[model samples]
Target chain A: MEVKNTKAYEVVIDSIKDMVFKRELKKGDKLPTERELAENLKVSRTSVREAIRALEIIGLVESKQGAGNYIKDDFATSLFEPLSVMFMLQESSPKDIFQLREVLELECCRLAAKNIKDYEMDRLLAIISEMKETDSEERSSILDKEFHNLITTTSRNKLIINVLNVVSKLIEISIKEYRSQIIDLFKNDRKLVEIHESIYLALRSRDEEKIIKAMEKHYTLIKQSVKM
Target chain B: MEVKNTKAYEVVIDSIKDMVFKRELKKGDKLPTERELAENLKVSRTSVREAIRALEIIGLVESKQGAGNYIKDDFATSLFEPLSVMFMLQESSPKDIFQLREVLELECCRLAAKNIKDYEMDRLLAIISEMKETDSEERSSILDKEFHNLITTTSRNKLIINVLNVVSKLIEISIKEYRSQIIDLFKNDRKLVEIHESIYLALRSRDEEKIIKAMEKHYTLIKQSVKM
Candidate 1:
């Protein structure tokens, strides 16, 4: 059953949520103590306490040893924390997550082509070059992450970045289990570098169609190389 | 600094996450008591309590004041709880969220076209017909949700469904703020019905290209109509 809207604790959560939206509170801002919140909202202290606990669990708030609860500063990480737990629950499949990654990364390329700052473009090219020189699978994978991350950053869409961060983490867990099988495939970094270059050239050209084609080819290659 | 990985509280979250993955714990299963968890994991009782609190916030675990904590059954909602909060924080623009919804729905249409069950197709057609008959803004909006929801469900991708659920909630909030302005545009339910029919027919055709084109036009119309 859907249980999001009815609980008293939810009322408190909603209040804080509205506060965040209205900018009465922000990242790292302190929330009033349970007793204070209870008095202000005309709810029992216990309910207020429960609401704070729920928010803390979700990473929207944190309770320090001596301090009261405060809004989390690293909201993006917190935003995906519950999602990470849900992954553990096997609520979603690896293939489903990978498909999402492909969609988001493709969009990221299209957006980056339009809005990528020159510095971000330079960073993307630099990471591609670094991947060419790196022989270690470990280093190559790190560059791979950086390359994709640059694209996400260039998208200038925080929501997309946050969504992708969650999807990428899920992908990482699934990929780790099959790393041994893909190690040989990944050893040929030249093809990988070339794919990224195609992406880079498209972004440099600032052509959305080319970006989409290049990214489609990039993910298709990765999809074929990795056996889920 | 990003402290998601380094905190003591995170250890507790990780342990519970591992349990869920290993199937030592299941949905609706009760977790060990806080004291018991602290002793077994060799952490302080307070740490265990904090962990439980955080998990509860994420909807992974629910606290039943008198009965202790049980794993929640609806984990997908939990997965997006923090993300909902992030939306309130305005980390994303309406355009970004709408862009995301477009990408996901396009994939949803493609997959749904390929995998939609006969019953699901019938349900989708029913919703479109219902939209055609309904002129009330409220009823049309509800049918609009059902139409999109059916597409996501028909996609048979739990991960995509979860991601879109979060995005949909964000869109709902933005739409509510501008409901009056768009109510006139939305009063033209015939156009809405026609767009959905296009999607429904494409899904029936089981042609991925037609589905993509139809879904793209559907969202492009929406993107133009919604100022946000």
Candidate 2:
């Protein structure tokens, strides 16, 4: 019973993946028509379509209205659906996801320390200054997210940014849950402001070790306070 | 142009994410009706529907034919799309992807070292034995992949297993490319067989450090042979 649910579509997907792996199907390679795939695999076109939709959701393939499905060279945009689903289903413990976030964000901070340009630094400072004036937790959270987003952007690697974006979204849900919890725990808005300021200073100083240390400290505090 | 692309859909997505983050939209909570959301956001129902579809694709919400969408409790499956896309797009250099695979596989080996039971160990050994006798490169590769898949399954974490599955698929592509570039790279089937045996022995012995070291060595050799 379990095999029927999982195996049929998997077989079709694996066949296509194998073609991609073998370079028989390169990026932008239009798949054989749906009928052809069904004939080749000895499976119903329904199963083939299911596999194709799954692939499409995952960003491996894209379908146009008139044009048939084509392989995507860039899979980032397509990743949102599957990633969103995985985050929802895993009952993923908050602690584990947060730990993963810390690792990724610390790496981001280190990269930003080394690579952030003067204009970016100026912009970051401006954001930090704006963050200092914001008292609303909702606004603060958005600013906090934007700060991290900016750090990732400055890293200038689409892969890292994409990863950060996904992980951040996953944790952002929990962060929102813990918003009041954080406010109650910290009580001192100044402390939160200081943490962001310190992180900004470390970035501006271009001290890789210091930046990693500060970012780690910031997340460690949040982890402790949230008890995730 | 870039800013324009980041439009209402993203805003709606983020707003829904905020609700999830806040625990306002708990698992199994029925989301706001599309009409209600459209009214609240001052957007067309069509736009709201588009956002909902995007969310559904990402595993954030599930929609039934008669019923409205409901929040998913966990997100393991939804993650496949984005992670796969990132793996394909960011992995510009095959070597970078291979390095990531080595890191992940080593982690898998370490996890398997302590956890693999006798039946699992036997299954792994049988896979290696099959690889030793398999004359077809295609068959050998499938066995090789299954061997790794077995280890991931034994890890007992869906998130880790899913990520490894994506990595393995990417590695399959890399391996095929490598084979094309260097004809007969797998001709010395005996050496490949020995490497798997060594890894299996490490797993059997339940030696975490040794398993990691062996997996790393094996991957390093693979990287050298692939050279790209």
Candidate 3:
């Protein structure tokens, strides 16, 4: 029966999932060849291949003409196909997306403060310094993205980082609208630089409360300033 | 240049996105034929079709071999592709996914409390009553889905509903695992039924705090009972 066959596939998928969760298999780790997997699981090669193909479509594995299938590390590309369509259908506004971003980025900031490595802190400081040197709004925007990307990376939660990355890309197409609305919020680039400095200090101190407060202040100010 | 052409296609996509967002066209609504769109937008049919094709991949529209493209009501199919891929790549645990579900469904419960219609409440109650009569685990699971679906519909936020629907599907596949845990924890169907009743009462009262509290209680119990 159709149901029985579906159940068989589900069992196959679950076994693979368990291995990944147990870390017996890891991200970017190559899975066994089809024949090997079938033999190990006592399933038909057809079932094993089907499960692998399904996982590939979902962005778990990449199969090339010659190269074996390799596990993917990043989650954003996997999310893009569905999220792009959802955003298109929902026609989510910049404001609505912004609200979601605020909730997520604030959490990221708090987590990064607690968990960011010294090297990451150095990189973040360098990015901020680079942003300070850039006079062009265009260059600054790119630097801004890098800054946020670093913060998200340090959050150490794949789901959060993936969702934030998708949201960032979706909003990138509308950056002009966002910029036009908030162009005058800062008196000069120095004020923006100063805010980043304060945030950096809070992060360096590993002060969770301070980090949350700083992030809230930064976002609230930006939101208010943009309204002008 | 390639850049210029991509920009033009983006413009076409944006215009259609605006129409959909503004509710000028809804799910199941037919779009103007490709030729009509080309004439109206002053773009080539090729450009229009390209944009539509991109949207189709994301699940906004469905084009039949003979029938024109129809707007899609549910975002499930569109969202599933990318999310499933992300799940596989991240190899997310049920706990991680459950955390997301908890946040999302709790939000849905709160929103439904404020917005659910009398008919919708009646439908939800009907499902619960039917679930009580059903001896089959499969039927009970179906009724459980309907209960959550009703709440999502009443939330009146398409974006939330779309995200929740995708999560719901993933959860459905794992419900047996979740149920066994809950059964182990509570050991009484009556207690489980009471939790749902309390949630339903919170909705009827339209008390946001009560809804949130009820959801927290329900999820906390679920978290304790379920094997993540």
Candidate 4:
């Protein structure tokens, strides 16, 4: 029964995809209104609505009130926000999320080592130092996010940044109730500070081999502290 | 005006997200009906419907025709179908998509090296042998995809497989008209077979360093032939 419900909605969406494949619909093109789409596709208005809604969520369509839904021109939005919630529900374990994060962050650090500017390096180093000085859990959390965001941004790949940002949010949700990965990098302050310092130093050196080592070390410490 | 349209729609969606954050919603939990959401949130029923539609597409919500919508229990659906459409339109060049595919495929090869079974090795070796003999362009293309898919499945990571599958589809769409990356892995055939052979051997041996070198070789060939 539930599967039927899934199919009815998917049928409508597939019809729409067919239109895309045939070049009948295009990016930034306004979709037909609900009634028209339902009538044309011979589906219920409700199904058409659901299909378009699903398309919008997948970052392919954008809804404009009083106007209508149009195909999105770019996918720069927080695509993984809903994706994160989906993970939070399905993946009871954080292993997949953690592994995906590690892969992207390593790539980010490797790229950052090559592309990071002097000022960006200074900012990251300062974030590490601030991590050392901060005693508040809230402060540690903020500094930790700032530290990674700076590095991810420095990597200069919008696609990686987009996906990584969502994965990081998933990580944040997992540990928000427990302790964040940063809070446990040492289970104490000094070790946490040093672990991050190593990352900062690796980026400063701009050595690919050293960057890989430093990134792996960072994940190892976090994985050790993490339940997963 | 465009900005206003974007915000009005976002407001309703943000309300739904807040519900998730506040613990008012749980996995597989049913959502309030459209009227209830419209009234409580003081938005139009149209807006509420659109919000839920967006959520459903993100794999965070499931809708039942008669029962109502529920927070989705899992996210194994093709979340990237629309995402691929989004990219096919926005990205005029395939550089970003190509780079992303390279990164994920490299990871897949690394994991496959460690996890692939003897039977899997035999199957992959056979596929490569077929690739060498196939003179039909269509057959070569299909075999090429099969070879990659087998390695990816052997990696045994659902999340990687999920994301990679979508990324692969995006690549297929990109070259569907011009020529696939595989078709161009070598403008001529022998180089293509040799390149993939290195990858297969590296995997069968399960040597991490060899796998990395082979994977890099594979991408370097494609990139040189690729306009990007």
Candidate 5:
């Protein structure tokens, strides 16, 4: 910021970050304007503006039209931005991404079994029935994502939900990339539908062990089917 | 990046992102120069420059001095930068952060037990001994982070290790923030050392169940002691 650093914008970014980390600046606290930050840090206003823009994109700070920049507390949304970017940048193997999703989704199923609300269970059943009726692979895949999303939402842990959102998105991409192979491996959609039904029944029963076993079998089948 | 958008730089950012995500531009692919991007997007060169800077910070692109910008493939480092910012932005409770770490670290312990090498076992012992010999809280915490870092590294799962790196860093911040309260709750450092020792012994014994039990006990003690 003082121009002592060649990367002036990075210096500005780090200065704000250090203040936040040290608790000098906190969530919802308003930051200095671009000009003020530049003057304070002895860098150009353009550098400060660019640094603030970077922070905004990553969900660290939010710009509310005329209200300037304020520190943000939306962890999930903040995480979602990078999580999306990570999906594009990292070419993870089908196995690696799906395996991670399997672990988190299993936990989701275990928790969903315990914490899912009645309305959520109804929704899950509706989705399953919808899946059973759909002949289109695309439609079924959409419902598959929704089903897993609902399970994660039902887990009731913000941390788990946030992390799983990222992992599951990557798995979605992997599935899409290998759709033909997956369909070829699992020729009978009935077995797939039955697996979902098993998970639904397990959730309805609120049995964690049964839920885990059901969810494990479900993903293990997918893992084997998409043997990339 | 056109002036049609109020945030011209944002348009430029989105354009590049869309290209990368759509696979028009790929890892190590060079981006248009600031002048060319500005012209292509009908945005000012300053806006284009700012957009590229933002992308560089996020690890989506790298500016190699005189070599222009190229897409980056280092997923974990890129994720780490935003993650540290998220840690500051989200004031997670000790329980929230530790719970996430427990989930991931438990997996780490399980995998480490299966995958840890003989040299890693020696290094694990060395770190624990360093912790035992240290009287300073700062030194102990450093060794503690190193110890957990090693466990995650031993897991041999890039996704797990990357995610744990971010979580453990937040936990480090949480511990530092609550250091006084934690020290007051557990004045005896010996118990802390013993817990780590139990984990190391279990890891050395190569019993996954024993490793998980010892690790769970260790985190449970901390969770109880912190009580936040």
Candidate 6:
């Protein structure tokens, strides 16, 4: 972000943020040119360049070589940056990530139970049967992710879905080996399938208490595999 | 981030992430020098600088003007960048944000009920009483944030606390005028204090069902004040 002075850099950043917050900047909108931004905000062209660079770094702004800066259409990509930084800093433990997932995934189950459509229920039923019949661990893990994702999507809350996806990815990344260790346990057991079946059944029944209980059981099983 | 080629820049970025994910780089650790990184990754020095700059803007790394880059100690500040951008893009509505908060705050209530300390409970009691006595809308709002923060902290989950803080800040920012509209409703109504009292009382009881019910009522009231 081309700044020798952090304070001036931050001031320019805040000015751009004010523009966005006030709705002067919008989705798919090109940022004002460095010269125009400098004149508008009373900052140097270098400072404006640094501000645009900062936004580009966060995945919020894209600097096309000749076309200039445009805000990205998708915003969720920016969430991953902070999370990765947190993981790198060891600010959060593997267990902390899992606990947050349990908190969120349970809510997903609750909301999904209330909001599931008929076709979605049929799809869930078919997935469960296929899960029960599958002997491949790779397929089972893929199905596991799908089942949870479908429930999260059914919650009908974009924020919840987005946060859960980020947390789940951290779970996969931060505890990469342990997750595989848990999946490996399935080679000798059918308990994974049973836990998911209970979750599906709980959702089908549309009982909030049962859904929470079932989801808690699912998390409990997974938590056992986590050493710390 | 300086780059003419997004593809090469992305590759450099991914390589740095891989280093962090694998724990090859760590907190407060300086990144490899430009030439070193370029040589090691078989990429250009410009690509390495772009990658470092990308990390720098995300608050993961701080580039000393004369020295080099080191990872930042605090990671949570980085989260606001994306949410603000998302709010600017209208990817998430104020309603979606509040819904997510409800999901999290209710879960926090459930966990806090199990884990809250006596000192914290005593503190909450004091705040609630002060909230009831205070006629100032501003004071009531401050107490409101305190009460919610205490419960979220007591949940004893770092990831949840960090994520909730980010969402709560977004609610304050994205719905700045709307939030004041709700707070303005508190001038003639003691309903805000009463709602918080129910939450505090439920926590004291440590009954999961009561806690959930009380928290639901709390959110129901707030959601009603929201125009959309």
Highest TM-score against the true fold, candidate: 1
- Reference-based lDDT, residue B49, model 5: 80
Runs off by more than 4 Å, candidate 4: A1-77, A174-187, B1-77, B88-93, B174-187
List of clashing residue pairs for candidate 3? A58-B85
Total clashes for model 3: 1
Model 5, B1-228: lDDT tens per residue? 335635887778778867866878877789988888888888899788878877877777888999898887565543475666665455655555766777778877887888899999999999999988988988887787788889988988777666665565676776676654556777757777888899999999989789879988887777677664
Write the number of the candidate with greater DockQ, choosing between 4 and 5.
5
**C-alpha lDDT of all candidate models, in order:** 0.77, 0.68, 0.68, 0.73, 0.76, 0.74
Over the stretch B87-170, how does candidate 3's per-residue lDDT look in tens digits? 545655676566556666776786677678899989878877887777776776677677777887787766556555555545
Q: Give one clash count per candidate, in the order shown.
A: 2, 26, 1, 2, 0, 0
lDDT of 1 by residue, B113-182 (tens): 8788999988988888888787688887778778888888888988888887777668777656444444
Interface RMSD of each: 2.4, 5.3, 6.2, 3.8, 2.2, 2.3
Pairs of colliding residues, candidate 1: A54-B57, A57-B54
All candidates in order of lDDT, best leading: 1, 5, 6, 4, 2, 3
Task: Candidate 5: give the clashing pairs.
Answer: none
- Cα miss at B166, model 4 (Å)? 3.3
Give DockQ per model, in order. Answer: 0.57, 0.12, 0.15, 0.33, 0.49, 0.51
- After superposition, the stretches of candidate 5 with alpha carbons farther than 4 Å from their true spots are A1-3, A22-29, A64-67, A72-79, A87-90, A178-180, B1-8, B18-29, B35-44, B72-79, B87-91, B177-186
Q: Tell me the tens digit of each residue's lDDT in model 2 across B58-111.
A: 456788778998876555533354355445545445645654455556656766
Model 3, A96-175: lDDT tens digits are: 56655666676678778767999999998998889788888888778777787899889776666656655565656555
- The docking quality of candidate 5, as DockQ, is 0.49
Per-model TM-score on C-alpha atoms? 0.87, 0.60, 0.65, 0.78, 0.86, 0.86
In candidate 3, position A219 carries an lDDT of: 71
State how far residue A15 of model 4 sits from its true place (Å). Answer: 7.2
lDDT of 1 by residue, A48-73 (tens): 87788767666678888788899987
Index of the highest-lDDT prediction: 1
- Per-residue error (Å), model 6, residue A134: 2.9
